[model samples]
Target: MTAPLSEQQLAEIAAREAAASKGPWLEGARRGNVPTLYRPLTSGDGVSTYPSVLFELTSVYGGPGDMAFIAAAREDVPALLAEVERLAARVTELEAEHPSRFAATPAEVDVYLRSILAEDTYLRYQQAIGSEAVREAMDDATAYRNCDDNASKKQAWRSGIDDALGYVDPDGDVGPYPSNLLCSQHNGFGPCPGYPWCTPSQDDTEPGDPS
Candidate 1:
């Protein structure tokens, strides 16, 4: 996948765009049956004319389409660059507001998900057990899990689950289950307790639980 443009790259593009000739450039009369581009000029009299030739399509392969694209780019590029910068700023603001939505890597996403699971577990345990120590321990575990260094190391089970879910092994090499089958327990209500988020019922056994 193509990496997102960095701020430096965006700034460099903006610099190039700023250095380019001021636009709203116009298509001028064809020269020798070849299309031409011109920058609009206005004198003190306020009469506008396309006297300044910006580009002349002299290449044997060049056509009207090429000339049109080049002329349009003069305006399109700046507008697009401005929009990119604005969106980038908005994304930064949104990431500040909701960091989970902006998880850029698999490891980061895993940590984000795990943190949510931890919070949910904490809340459930607090309600069920009513113990402050359990809550504190859950908080500690969440903080430890969220450390940047531990993100990748903690994701081993993600591959296993993905394999089980047929994401990695769609051919069913990981298990007998078909890729198309959805868990009966996870029907619209929420994820089952066998997974990370749910609380197991008395009849339910957590995945990989020997009991």
Candidate 2:
């Protein structure tokens, strides 16, 4: 009687089969037509378009002092996308080898999965870096939205906040208090707890006030 193939022999067979099955898809992916087994980015808005994540990363206020950091991130985007594509190609190669006559060993799948994850993480890092400038621009554009001169804008902002607060606290009336102001008399530090701002007035010193 013929002996069954050993695990090592089985692994070899699986690898060969996977390689053959994945060749067509791999070729297509090289031309940017990666099959269903490979999807690099869900949104095909093009590389030039700003991703939401990139927008968020650069959205923080840093003034002219942050120019260097933003520039550095923008430089990293291409590098990140390249790495993402590289890993995606590898994943497709591995996945195409699926459903072979021989059972695919767990170790083979694990290595492929790890490669995909590493590339994806690198891509995200690059995108965040790329979006820094766009985010900064967005922040700068809206910088004047809170100025005292822009009373209409400020009122709109306050009204929105109040509406949100009311929605959350339907039983109570919520208004913009001193604690919510941008500058305070306390050296512009923040709202003082001693002030009757967001907190209710304390009449503890009044004798028999609550008895």
Best model number under lDDT: 1
Off by over 4 Å in 1: 1-61, 101-211
Q: Over the stretch 173-206, how does candidate 2's per-residue lDDT look in tens digits?
A: 2212222211133333332333322212332423
RMSD of each: 18.9, 27.7
Clashing residue pairs, backbone N/CA/C < 3 A, model 2:
18-97, 73-129
**Candidate 2, overall lDDT?**
0.39
All candidates' TM-scores? 0.25, 0.18
User: Model 2: what TM-score?
Assistant: 0.18
